[model samples]
Target chain A: MTEMPATEMPATRFPKEIAPWDVIELTIPVRTDLVVLARLTAATLASRVGFDVEEIEDLRLAVEELCLSLVRNGDDGRLRLRYTREGDDGIAIACTFEAAPGRGLRELPVDDLSIRILDALVDEHGRSSEGGHKRAWLRKRRSRTVA
Target chain B: MEQAFDISEREGTAAPVVSVSGEIDVATAPSLRNRLQARVAGGDTTVVVDLAHVSFLDSTALGVLVGALKRCREAGGDLRLVITEPRILKVFEITGLTEVFSIHPTVDEALEAPPR
Candidate 1:
């Protein structure tokens, strides 16, 4: 994978090696009413990936926060989400938002309480920007005992 | 779009009980906040919020709860919560709010507790 700008560090990078089994992608209008669709999708995918009840709930909340951030900061463009499962127990989610013209990919406010909540739920998270779009990504590894 | 959120309030023996079910996110948190604020504004010092039926809760909802707690305390009242779902409980634990709010297993217990 190509290196993204240091300021936009985490969103563009992928795992060094990944053998994904299933991939799910969605693009929805940037509206508050549509945020639940993303949350439900994350929960369903996390559960299908054999995540325990707690992990599934965590993923659901994390995805909601990501979508909320995009809707709060994004232009009137649609938001895109991609969920990928690697091997058997690893799940990764990437959310990309289209920036309004003249407004480059601005960083999602890190100091916000929502970001803090997302940090506590996911194992790892990062954000990056390229062209006029920005992406935020989160990764979680299913518990060995459960999966 | 139809909202997946609902809030119902009933008069309890000690205080007003607000039962919230369904998803609480950015779009619906304001409703919850307004309900809680009204309870505080009504001179009810002790309020119990039942979240056992809430299927989903996000950080925005959490922030609203925290804000309500502060408002209640400032007005010489306090807000208590009744939560039993592990998923909802985990959000409190992750945010260290488990210690901030007076959490009870049931609305009855929350109402029985002494006001702060």
Candidate 2:
């Protein structure tokens, strides 16, 4: 068995937060390798948004959950990420994808365990219909003081 | 893209309870994370994440739990993990998380502990 080169691993552009903070979006192919890349990218972005060690971990988890949801929905298209900064509170991130009916994210019962955990990881979350696509939005609050 | 495990958690008066009854591989770890996050969001700090029913656990799953503990602490709370199976406990022990977080022999013990 041969090993993959470090550079061959999934790599994406790191968006810069110029105006206090701006939502950075990226499109990556729906592949497991890219999923790991997405997770790492989210971690880097969270750090840039002034997340502490703990907050970084939370962001990573959020990204993983979002990507996992996409994978489950057979969202093998492009993975979309929206990164934004919420005033004094923290950064808001959204990872979305397109899925067919009864395919994307079914509304887990309000008391559902997974839904509850996803909500806790982020400060704000919801689902919406846009352009005949179902999207899941997740927000991560920055714990550090904005400079 | 892969099939993952199904995770569920319930909070009692004393401790929060978690039930993971499937494969906790990369595909299913997110569900576990999602469920764990929900519990923390509801202001339930002292948590008992039961791993007894789980047959599998990977690094991603471990990361999810560790992150959950960090979140609980930030919110002035803590997490207790229950691992009755030897395989799961071995992972905790190998990862050194066994020393980092409180691990109980049963879910009852985890839930019974006073909130931190």
Candidate 3:
């Protein structure tokens, strides 16, 4: 695997209100092999928060898509993922990266099939950029009853 | 880096069958694409992808499959899939690709199906 640089961001970058039980944060090198680590982390969190089998699968795929999108657009950066359990039955995931010089997040292909897949699997999603860093947020609400 | 996935091909009863077993994601997608492209380039019109052993499927991998299918059809051949894992199948369903590709429960079923 190609050696990619990774930096650990200070926890202060996140909201101060993050409860230990509700938040799981990971910083992984922006390598394809490690994308599975992010996906499995998201799945485990979602499952713990009461997401059904199907919903957990959806979250897994959505997280993987998010990572792939960032890796494709950003030439070099560590992937920072934050998963938070919403009140009772919802999960929200945030992914962000400080892209390499000349490789900003604006070039990400938002209209591609991968984005469409993310949209279909998640309840809501949004993107934003500031200071050369880009972030994608996805939220999924667990069904009250599993079929 | 060595690819995390592998693709092996064999002659089926009626078409060429490729069995892929591993997680298909960004890192491994290019390898899958190259193998499928080579098979299509070799003039095997009909191809069946056996994905029962695939533990994970991402959009990049799905895009590779879609691209391969398009190439095969343009060459007057087709691509079919044998998928049984519901987790992997859910990815196809969410993308609405279940309707786009001919999916069967087994490789034998895919090879025995009437030609498209």
All candidates' lDDT scores? 0.78, 0.63, 0.79
lDDT (Cα, tens digit) per residue for candidate 3, span B1-116: 21346778897468888999878888888888998999999988889999998988888898899999999999998899999998888788877889899999999899888867
Which lDDT tens digits does candidate 3 get at residues A1-147? 111223232223234465787988899977777888898899889888788778887888898877766667236778899888776677788898766566555445553667678778887776666457777777888887644
Global local distance difference test of model 3 = 0.79
Candidate 2 shows a clash count of 7
**Who is ahead in DockQ, 1 or 2?**
1
The best-first sequence of candidates by DockQ reads: 3, 1, 2
lDDT string, candidate 2, A51-139, tens digits: 88767766665666655543443444666777765544566556666443355443321212234345556766555545554455667
Pairs clashing within candidate 1? none
**Can you give the TM-score per candidate against the true fold?**
0.84, 0.47, 0.84
Which model scores highest in TM-score? 3
Better of 1 and 3 by DockQ: 3
Model 1 residue A26 CA deviation (Å) reads 0.7
Q: What is the DockQ of each candidate?
A: 0.65, 0.05, 0.68
DockQ of 2: 0.05
Name the regions of candidate 1 deviating beyond 4 angstroms.
A1-21, A73-75, A100-108, A145-147, B1-4
Q: For all candidates listed, what's the TM-score of chain B alone?
A: 0.92, 0.86, 0.93
**Model 1 C-alpha lDDT per residue in residues B41-64, reported as the tens digit of each score:** 878777889998898888789889
